[model samples]
Target chain A: MDVETLALVQQLYGAQSHYIDEGHAREWAATFTPDGEFHSPSYPAPVAGTEALTKFAADFARQDGVTRHVLTNVHVTPAAGGLTVRAYLQIVRTLPGGPPELLRQTTITDDLVRHAGTWRIRRRTVRRDDMKENR
Target chain B: MDVETLALVQQLYGAQSHYIDEGHAREWAATFTPDGEFHSPSYPAPVAGTEALTKFAADFARQDGVTRHVLTNVHVTPAAGGLTVRAYLQIVRTLPGGPPELLRQTTITDDLVRHAGTWRIRRRTVRRDDMKENR
Candidate 1:
């Protein structure tokens, strides 16, 4: 991948993590293309577009406080239409009246496109490897 | 990152998914450097080295029939000593006792290095997004 594109990906991810950690769930959802697709293997089905993405994050905001998502091991490839990326991530959630714990950890594969002079996620899928809860 | 290094990252991830789908868990572990670390946010701790990686996979061998791990949306950047990558992933696990279900989905971020002329994963972390299970 080109250096500029690669750099953009890093910046995109950094923004994502920042948005999630700051609890601006709606802004986080806006980082995607208008018709983007978000799928987590753990979720029953894919959530499409910015609206659904916003709704998904909003749901999390209800039960959790101070969530941190860390992304690393990024792999990017140039595809016919856009850039495809694979990354490993770890998420720690600290909820009210509970100790901080790892909520989920998995791999995220995403397809991103540069539109209107900015990179936006077009498709995203998450795969969970291991999980534990302190409930 | 240099083209060669970026290419290596893509190759490494492809190989990882291949090993997982093919059920060659041991071989999968060998793709890491001697002192590599594998941490899935879902998992409590990181699995270190080839030996530990192998043991972790062997544990999975007892339960599931076939598992598919798909990595995409790869982003890679050159660091001072190695390259860092982030990608999204989707995993489908099928067991003998039940229909195929989406067990876990997350993102994986990894740190990789070129050791002995081949790229090996040095560190890996996963973050789970969503999941659904069919009993």
Candidate 2:
């Protein structure tokens, strides 16, 4: 029943990875809803809405080197208004003339809804493995 | 077309990750064909056949830290007899008192075949991102 939905979810995630890794800030933010929420302990505060999300992506792109945002162990579940997707995310970064470093590891839970004939994240909650206060 | 096949492939990989991370050595190796092959630059020698593959997995379980084997950016292509799966592989490790470290990042190409009513890797080649001598 959700065969196609599963595929669409995977496609969106693949695109999200590319958008952030390549510094496509606006494109990355566009993956989320206009008032999407992003909550994480790593950030100074929870970022929500379109404008802030765009700025967050832009700021993330100012790193000193290459960054690969990898997602794995994905699971999708049907929800009331949309779909719920959860996956493990790893942030690997490589500095200039240095080796790639495993910067962060976390779990991302996203509530997705249909927007503009495609999937858009309505809210995303990230729980870092190293941090114990995800709640 | 490949909707079901891709899901099966993803499930197999997810199982593989757990088999290794949880130190189920034999179970991990069993995901490979009886005469499967695994070639990687990190290992001193290429491992092939059931006996060798089982041994390789067993040896890997002796690490002094916890390791997470992550696979992302998966792409599956239909093959003449089976399927070809390619993805980026990341190894994250954390010692008893240290933070998680990105140990290795590589590309893995696998030739998969149905064995005993389940998909099994017939051959796997790992190309480390830091190594250019993949040829």
Candidate 3:
């Protein structure tokens, strides 16, 4: 991938992280396409569509406190649709009366489309690894 | 990073994925540097060094079945010592009596160095998102 594409992917990741951390569920949901699919290995079913995703985010926001989502090892490939990006993420969640928990260690596989010149998630599947009990 | 570097990163991901899925734990563990640290957010402590990582992988190999790990959105930047790469991954694991599980969706952050002219992971950290119970 070129530098520009890499930068754009990073920007999209940053936006998603910001929305999630800031408790802007609606905005976070808007990061995807109208008929987007958000798949997480932990979830029984894939969260489909922008509206549904928005609602899910809203509910998730009711949790105790802040979270820091770190993205690394981002790989982007040019595709007919737009860009296929894969990233490994580390999410640290700090809740009330507890220390920050290393919530997940997994990879994000996503198909992003450029809508009006901005990258948005068209399909996302999250794979989780090493699920351990918190101390 | 240039094409050569990007290709190298992809190769590394493929190697790790192959070893993990095929139960070649010791070989998989050798992909890292001697003092390497494998950090998964879900784990309380990072898996350190080549030997320890090998043992850990060997144990993990006793699990059920085959897995397909897909890597996308790979971004690589030139670092002082070697290269830093970030990628999102989707790992699909299929066991004997169950359907394929999207094991994890996360980002992989790693520092890689050229040892004997070949890239090896010096350190790696995995972050996960959206944990849902499997059906």
Question: What TM-score quantifies how close candidate 3 is to the native fold?
Answer: 0.53
Give me the displacement of residue B129 in model 3, in angstroms. 27
Candidate 1's displacement at residue A33, Å, is: 0.4
Task: Please provide, for model 3 over A1-135, each residue's C-alpha lDDT reduced to its tens digit, 9 standing for 90 to 100.
Answer: 555666677678878877877789888998898998998866778899988999888877787787777665555767887988876666678988888766655567889998867889999987655432210
Better by DockQ, candidate 2 or 1: 2
Which is better, 1 or 2, measured by TM-score?
A: 2
For candidate 3, the TM-score of chain A alone versus the native chain A is 0.86
What digit string (tens of lDDT, one per residue) describes model 1 on residues A30-135? 8889898988766788999889888887776666477777665566777778888877666777878888765555667798898779889999887665422100
Instruction: State the local distance difference test value for candidate 1.
Output: 0.73
**Deviation (Å) of B14 in candidate 2:** 5.1
Lowest lDDT block of 10, candidate 3 chain B: B126-135
Give lDDT per model, in order: 0.73, 0.83, 0.74
For candidate 2 chain A, the 10 contiguous residues with the lowest summed lDDT are A126-135
lDDT of 1 by residue, B107-129 (tens): 87788887988878888877778
Candidate 1's C-alpha runs over 4 A off are: A96-98, A130-135, B1-135
Per residue, candidate 2 scores C-alpha lDDT tens digits across B20-133 of: 765788988998999999999998889999899888888887877667787777888989789999998888876644578878899999999999987899999999988879
Tens digits of per-residue lDDT, candidate 2, A34-117, equal 999999888889999889999998898997899998788776767899988777788888999998877877778899999999
Q: How high is the lDDT of residue A3 in model 1?
A: 57
